[model samples]
Target: MIEVRAPEPGDLETIGREAREEWVRDRFRTGVDFSPLMDKPNTHVALIDGQPVAAGGFIDRGNGNAIAWSVLGRVDERHFVGLVRAFRKYMKATPYRWIEAHCIATFHQSHRWVKCLGFVPVNGERCFTPDGREFRKYVFRNHNGS
Candidate 1:
C-alpha cells in the first residue's frame, strides 16, 4: 500500500536513495541534486510499505501563487504513478491562484505527469535554472483562475 503524508526528517535516507535512482533513469544532463523540502509547510513524501519512494512540494511564490516540484525515488514504477496522482489532487486543494512546475525540456515523463495533473504547457516558453539548465515551464490553474 502507498501512503502520502507530510514528511519527517528520518524519511530522507530512503528518499535520497530513490532520488539517485531517478537521476540514473532520467539521465538528467546536469544531474539532479535531491533535496527534500521537509521544513516547508507544503511538502510531502510518498511511501510504499512504510518506505519513502518519492517526495515533493510547492513553494509559495507570493501573491497567492506557487512553484511546484517533485522527485521520484527508485521503486516500482507502477506504484509511483499513483503517488504522482495523489500529489496532484493534494496540490489542487491549495487556495492558490496558480501553481507552476518546472521540468527539464528533455524530461518527457515529467511533461506527461504535469499534463496528467492538469497543467498546460506555456507554449513557446522556456527558462533556465540558476545553474543554467534549461527547462520548460507548466502552469496549473483551476477554472476559477482560468
Candidate 2:
C-alpha cells in the first residue's frame, strides 16, 4: 500500500540512492536541491510499505501562484497509477490557485503524467535550464479558487 504523508529528513537521500542517472545528473548540474523543500509547508513523501517512492510539493511564488516540484525513486510499474492518484489528491488539497511545473521537452512520459494530474502545457513558453536542456512549462489553474 502506498501511503502519502509529511516528508522525513532522509526521504530525499533514500530516493537519490535509486534515482535514474539522468535525473541525478540534471539535479546536480542545475543545483536543484530537495533539502530546503523538506522545510516547506505541504511537502510530502509517498511511502510504499514504509519505503519512500517519491517526495515533492509546492514552492509559493506568491499572488496565488506556486511552483510544483518532485523527485522520484525507483518505482514499481504496478504502483504508478496509485502514485498518480495520490499526487492528484495532494495537489487538489493545496490552497494555491495556480501551480506551475516544468518538464524536459523530450520526456514524453513526464508530459503525460503531468497532464494526468490536471496540468496543461503553456503555449510557446519553453525554457532552458542551466544544463541547456529544453523544458516545457505546465500549469494547473483552479479558476474557482481564490
Candidate 3:
C-alpha cells in the first residue's frame, strides 16, 4: 500500500535524488538541485512499500493562501487520490485558502491529473528550457474557502 506522510530529515537525500532523476528524464537537464526545499517542515513524501516515490510541499504565502508544488512518477491513481484528499484537509486546517501548481506542458498526464482535482487553469505562457527551447507553462489553482 502507498502511504502519504510528513517528510523526515533522513528522507531528504532520497527525495532529492529521485527528483533530480525525474528532472533529467523529463527535461533533459542534469545538475538540478532540490536542497533548498528538502527538510522543510511543510514538505511531504509518498511511500510505497516503505520506499519514497513522490514528494511535494507548500509555501505559506500568508493572506490565507499558499503556493504548492509536487513531483510525481508513474503512480497508481488510488494513491494519488489519497494524497490529494489528505492535502485538501491539510490546506483547510491551515491558513491557506488556495493551492497553486505550475506544470510544464510536456507533462500531459500531470495536467490531466490537476484538472481532475478541480484545479482551474488561471494562465499559461512560454517558459524557456535550459537549452533555450520554449515550453508551455500551465498554472493551476484550487480555491478552498469558497
Candidate 4:
C-alpha cells in the first residue's frame, strides 16, 4: 500500500540521495539540494511498502497561502491519487487558504494530472536552467480544499 506521512530525520539521507540522483538524471547541477527546502514543518513523503517514492512540502508565503512542490518518481496512478488525497487532508487542517505549484511544461503527464486534480493554470513564466536553456513554467493553483 502507498502511504503519505511527515518526513522523519532518518529519511533525510535517503531523500537527499534520491533528490541528487534525480537532479543528475534530469541534467541538473549537483548542488540541487532539497534538504533545506524540505526542512519545513509540513514536509512529507509518499511511501510504498515503506519505500519512499516521492517527497513534497508546503511553504507558507505568509499571506494565508502556501506553495507546494512534489518530486515524484515513476509510479502508478493509485499512489499518485493517494498522495493527493493525503495532501488535501494535511492542508485542510492547516492555516493555508490557498495552494499552488509550478510545473515544468515538458512534463505533459504532470500537467494533465494536476489539471485532473483541480489545479488550473493561473499563469506562465519563463525559467532558465543553469546553462541558460529556457523552459516554460506553468503555475497551477487549487482552492476550495483541493
lDDT of each: 0.75, 0.84, 0.60, 0.62
Candidate 4 lands at a TM-score of 0.69
Report the C-alpha lDDT of model 2 over 26-79, residue by residue, as the tens digit: 654564666788889879999989999888899998898988988777888999
Candidate 1 residue 74 Cα shift, in angstroms, is 2.0
Q: What digit string (tens of lDDT, one per residue) describes model 3 on residues 50-87?
A: 87766777776776566666665545556767766655
How well does each candidate superpose onto the true structure, as a TM-score?
0.80, 0.87, 0.65, 0.69
Candidate 4 clash pair list: none
What ranking emerges by lDDT with the best candidate at the front? 2, 1, 4, 3
Clashing residue pairs, candidate 3?
64-97
Residue range 35-108, candidate 4, lDDT tens digits: 77678887887787787766777788887778776665555666767767765566556566677765665656
RMSD of 1: 3.9
Q: 48, model 4: CA deviation in Å?
A: 1.0
Overlapping backbone residue pairs in candidate 3 total: 1
For 52-136, candidate 1 gives per-residue lDDT tens digits of: 8877788888878889877666768678568767887778777677889998887787787788788988988879978888999
- Score candidate 4 by lDDT: 0.62
Superposed model 3: Cα runs more than 4 Å off: 9-31, 123-146
lDDT of model 4 at position 20? 29
Candidate 2 ranges beyond 4 A from true positions:
25-33, 143-145
Identify the superior model by lDDT, candidate 1 or candidate 4: 1
Error of 3 at 102 (Å): 0.9
Question: Considering every candidate listed, which one attains the maximal TM-score?
Answer: 2
